[model samples]
Target: MKKQSFHIDGAKVTVYLDGPAWDGKPSATLGAFSCKTMQSGTSVLAQAISFVRDQGLNQIIGPMDGDTWHSYRFVTQTDGSPSFLLEPGNTPDALEVFKKAGFTEISGYFSARVPVVKTALTTPTATTDFTIEAWNGTHPEALFDQVFNLSTQAFARNAFFKPITRDDFMAMYMPMVPMLKPELIFFARQPDQTLAGFLFGTPNYAEGPKPTSAILKTYASLSKGAGQHLAHAFHKAAAAEGYETAIHALIHDDNLSAIRSASEGADIFRRYGLFGLKLNG
Candidate 1:
């Protein structure tokens, strides 16, 4: 991947060429797109387009910081709800800027929310070979190592997935350690003590003055029903913690996780987009 930048009349934009796409494909992306753009101030957009052409890239995806590992989508639809933690915040003008620059929606994502009480009765079928436990801040490194291993396989087929070293993975989560609530994170283990799944949750730090909500950040499984088992256990634990609302953060429209969120009575309150443009157009 190659990184390039531009400064057009004091407006700066950054672009990446041949980077990983959501589906682990390679594509060019325009990002770090910042400017007080108006109808007359669209030079920045034109410059970005020029950069894509100069790179000999046939297509360009945008607003992606670099990859899915960081921030990527634009908030294409919203119910006027306040943003949640890790949620992308896009301005109205930013959306128009991309649209005017010949970009089209290439992918869609949504975040949903459900009341903890609604999922209180959610229970996955019992699996005799697997056991579930809460993450209690015990030997976090070891736990993370196990999670990284499972994730390497579980998310290998996921969009924009890039193989990362164990150290890099731990480093990413280490900063969030202070905000972690043990009850909200769970792990599923097999009879042989192999880690099979994990569910990560966090307090809704984005909810107004005080966060009455929590976010189901991410979860992965190496066994059947393990994901559901972890979610059920995590939701019950969140309810016990007095959290009224639970957010299913950023589910792809066609992803199975979205169905699970819907089954739990969650409603899609926010939608996001990853835009793309063909250089020839």
Candidate 2:
């Protein structure tokens, strides 16, 4: 088997595929891990990132093997319970290596799977306080911009936040619009009619076991009560769309807000983690 490898002083490195493609662009990715120390690890990561960038990749997000949305996370502890980022070994440093290489944390997402039998999974609870709505029109660039703005603000508290350039954001979502089924996207609005947050999902209601689409990625504004209320409302939207199980797409352990949101939901599931890096900027 002819395989390619990149090695840095006294270390062996490997690259792995992240996901399917659209119009020849990478859809998602997660770079594999096999580093020894700070120097070698950082070198290996930098080389990998530069390679992805050279490939004409629009935006790169990880602990992931590929893009910004899949298989990417940093483990903080060995307790097997990352409750509160459980103080894991060498994780904090790995990301540090990434940061040194010019990457930034853009947005933090989550994972929650509503069981099929939980018939009430999609219905918002009576105690829910926010107003949940959907974007019903065609290719609302304004709506997507709004989602980017609201989520950017909500995610500002992120330790490694790197403002996603408008171009980058668009490049990531534009391909998924048709695949995302906007009707299933639920937005949480405040009394003032501002987009406080939202949730997006795709239903795999087709006759076969294959997902009706690829993994559905959700974005929302993080605010007071935004976590639970938005989750419930989004759940309602997802069920109405006919999904068998809800998949919370991408997430990070360092993201305090997302971690909190996961707690409020009853059925939260996960996909994968990415390798994260911090940019010198």
Candidate 3:
């Protein structure tokens, strides 16, 4: 993707020319966005808009680094909780910076927390179509390859979805292997040994060395009921491991995952959004 950076006053933003489509039209994405003052933010955004329009694109989205595979969205609301590991964060004025630049919320997401014991007790028993297994902490590379494949298939239809190379996906996750708790990551497999789903959870390392909460970072399913079964297995394992809470991280508002979180008694503690701006020709 071709990228250009724009700066105004103390603010800076990067414009990615070959961004994912918006409403079926080509879009330019703004990333690495930062600004101390609204005036500077607006000015820099104007420069980005002009540059994109000159390239024959009229739609823009940000503050995604490039696509959904990377960090994106601004924290729009919070309940005073501290951020978790790998959570995307921005300056206090980040949301307003985009709003003042004529950007509107194009997508919404949330993070929720639930009691591990409660979720474990309430989750339905596993379906017979798939059996859940935990990662054995061996051959970490192979583990992520399976995850990357399942993720690409499961999230293919998601909004702003973009395919990432397996190497890029592995590079993004391999470093976290040391922090992973084998019991918290699960794989759902069919009778023929085909992988149907996976759940990757980690301890809230940001909460310090001995954390009480587990973060359900991500999970995806290709078969019916596999996702729910994997989640059930994760919660049971987390509770057994003495984790008191589970954080369902970065769930899209309309996704079944969000509904599952709520049904498991998770309460929304934070909200996030992606912003978009439409330029006039």
lDDT of all predictions: 0.81, 0.52, 0.89
lDDT of model 1, residue 135: 86
lDDT (tens digit, per residue) of candidate 3 on 30-110? 999988887888788888888988999889999888889888999999998999999999887767878887899999999
Query: Of the candidates shown, which would achieve the greatest lDDT relative to the real structure?
Result: 3
The 10-residue segment with the lowest total lDDT in model 1: 18-27
Candidate 2 lDDT over 1-281, as tens digits, reads 11235688744444433433423444323355556678888787667656655554544455543433323465422323222111113345666676676655544344444443253343534534457777685656877888788767876654434356677788777776665566667778777787878766555434244553222355656556665565565556555655555445445545543564455453443322333332221
Winner of 2 and 3 under TM-score: 3
Q: What's the lDDT of the predicted structure labeled candidate 2?
A: 0.52
For model 1, residues 149-227, the per-residue Cα lDDT tens digits are: 9888998887666577777789887778777888899999999888989999989887765678989999999888888
Question: Which residue ranges in model 3 land beyond 4 Å of their true spot?
Answer: none
Task: Report lDDT (Cα) of residue 240, candidate 3.
Answer: 97
